[model samples]
Target: MSNETEPAPAAHGQPTLKAIADAVGVHVSTVSRALKRDPESPDASKSVRRIHRIAEQMGYRPNLMAAGLRTNRSYTIGVVMPRLTDVVIAQTCEAIEEAATAAGYQILLATPPDEVNAQLQSIQMLASRRIDGLIVSSIHLDRPDMVEEILRAGIPTIAVNRRADGKLHAVTTDDYHGGYLAGEHLVNLGHRRIGIVAGPRHASTAWDRTQGCIEAITSRGIEVDEELIVHTDFEVQGGISGAHRLLNLADPPTAIFAVNDTAAIGVAGAVRDRGLSIPRDISLVGYNDIPLVSQLPVPFTTISSPAAPMGSVALQQLLRGINEGEMSSLKLPVSLIVRASTTVPRQN
Candidate 1:
């Protein structure tokens, strides 16, 4: 009404698809097809690149939620872990999240403290959020009740880090072979009296590693004394207690194998507390070579489970189940990493 220059129609701060189309000299449909990466669009590849470049320059971000309304999908996956405090799971989940974002999906994370009932509640809650699939990074061993809940919910799921008994899909390391490698390494170092710090007795990891170690030891005509093996939580305190007990035995072991890195660190602490030195008094080996293990004062010899590849493969399986009704269990290989922590025993 006044001489105020008509306000320039109040510059729209948010860029829209139409703005991108007009800027790139294309129709809105062509802009959309370019944004969606639809190959069949009449828009040429160079035009698509130009549209994308302009969209970025204009600060245009796609509304995934709004697109989801038309697509009937949340384009989100739920990732479940026992605890993010655990380095192995945290790093692997980082890889999964990165890969998922690159593949145009979002991730919702949950940690239920490794309790089956709590996990069931978590699954139900994530399902209510309409997550497209779930990646359970930790599973309680042999919990049929939990497995039943997951199946009944009708959600696509892939187990990571651990696996079920062919009941559901999983992507995990070759734990059996990993344990065998640890055993063969120690046994080949001329260690006969070996102690085991096996993680939770009920878990498949503990069972399979135990069996594989036993097999490898026996293959060399060495009898594994049942009294030398101990099952405990995969924590520092648990490993300390187990290691202390083994060291106090009538025929103390010359080498100890812990099924987890945390426990292995604890065993190392136990050795030092007793005024003993590694490789001279005792040798130690760990599984799942978490980064911190290598940085320890006495770096642990360990099995390098492919954490990144495991996460990638798990997501791949989940996507396949979501898109093609196909999911299969997968086992990736692991290799042993030798370091200062393991060597030939003094007596040998």
Candidate 2:
């Protein structure tokens, strides 16, 4: 017999197949097969059950990277999400991560600028890592080149938050309906002259919301003042600039509907600078009832989009596409939240 002493497994390190096999008095191949088999299966062999018990005691975890090399499946998901600094985006990504983890997959995330070139680079990098699937959140409505490249890659893909001009499966909020709700609320409050802090037109989310708001206003026999609509970035500064432009108009609107809560905060600042107050000089409505909006001193009247659910549903759709060669688009519903920031327009 050889005189070599058995090596002890590390206390804080991952347990290897050899370690588990040795503990179970079996060969490494047997241990590998046992690990691959479902431990909870009612028909598992007695030997398999014993191996699993010992493996559990040793805290063994399969080497997915190593197995992927042989199986040709990385079992990893790639995510290209921009504006992660935004609360809504952050919440959505967190949900995606949670869902991916629960589904026995890991995510390789890239948070590049929302520009097409930058996003393309990120996608390329993720592809190099052999991602099994992809989720994109910043697809521009006016640009289809990057989306075409993604489709050509033949990897299962899903879009979230924004659609790819209907070129890809998407999980998004009903932004149009959300905008309509905001406009309808303001109009019901007797504010006929309304202004819109529309976001960039490149994003379908912004354009759809703008169109929906306009539809609500015009459907009520109110002529929308084209001059009242200001398209800008989706940031607070954009909101501030748009608000100033609308307020400077010859006939300023009595109500302002900002496409996002962050922008609405900026609009509020502009109102304060103009020595005006919300619902007094201008009734303010915003989309996306982020947690901070509800805590604001003048709580925002906003549309509550399902950010977390969108992420979760996107993951499910991508998995279906990856496994069953099936995919479909989804649009989660949104609701309007009445808060202190909105009320009947002040009597002139």
Candidate 3:
């Protein structure tokens, strides 16, 4: 034998359940039950808090990968959004996280490069993670394959703001009512010639909102000039470009309604650039009532999409599906908010 001694094998990292049990002076099974906050366990709340505190002090992290392999569940939900930069999406995501945590689930978020690919990648990643469920908040929902994939994974999936073509459950706002409200508000303000800035044609929300607005206007005997209705991306640049096209018409509309707040802001900027005073020259309305709308130089009249409630409802529905195998779609109501940007048009 050599004089040099072999180094002792490095001590393995402490297992989370074992460390929690040792710190709490309880059996590993009790630690597991306590950490799960099982209702059947006696004094589970107190035991859970005690175990959680000890686990934190010991720098213990649960081996989710190994647990997922064993149980076929990660106790996590996959949340996908078109873009985290969008204020409405970000707020909804925050609410989703809170709701998931309250239900003892963690969230894994994915923002895809584009709306179409985001849906595909998010579903695939979540399936690979063995997630308990998924919540999709992106705008693209025309693909039937997305629904088939989710069903193939054999996990619950809920769509928000976009409805899939198949039997998949969905949670969305009443887009038609939102559009009708916008149209009625403009009509009541004595606007006869109204223009619309709609989102992408493929988005169901855009189609429904446009239909509602057209119906409301036509029912009141107001003519909807086909040329005044423009469909574009739900972004500021789209608003700017659509507004330019509308204003260039032989007889421009007295009021313009944008499908979202970002586009409305763009319309407002474009109108100002042309030295036109809002309501006096052109009235503007927007949807989704994002926080930024209220803080603008002229507060925008908008339809509140109830994003937080939608998120909470979606999570609650997902949990139900996870525990009871129930799946159902839900449509939350929308409310119109009158603000400074809309007014009676001034006669030339």
TM per candidate: 0.84, 0.84, 0.80
Residue-level lDDT of model 1, residues 1-348, one tens digit each, is 644221111146757777777776779998987786522223338777666667767776667888789878798999888868878788779888877775568999988878788888888889999999999876767677777778898989988988877788889989999999999999999999989998886677777777778788989999999888999888899899999999999899999999989989889999999999986899999999998989988888999988888887788778778766888898999999999999888963
List clashing residue pairs in candidate 1. none
Q: Indicate whether candidate 2 or candidate 3 has the larger lDDT.
A: 2
Residue 245 in candidate 3 has what lDDT? 86
Tens digit of lDDT per residue, candidate 2, span 170-192?
99999999999988999999988
- Could you say which candidate leads in lDDT? 2
RMSDs, each prediction?
A: 6.9, 6.9, 8.8
How high is the CA lDDT of each candidate model? 0.84, 0.89, 0.81
Tell me which of candidates 1 and 2 scores higher on lDDT. 2
The sequence of per-residue lDDT tens digits that candidate 3 reaches over residues 206-275 is 8888888888899999889899899988889889988988899999999999988998888988898889
For model 3, state the Cα shift of residue 274 in Å. Answer: 1.2
TM-score computed on alpha carbons, candidate 2: 0.84
Q: Which stretches of candidate 2 lie over 4 Å from their true place?
A: 1-62
Clashes of 1: 0
lDDT of 3 at 180: 97
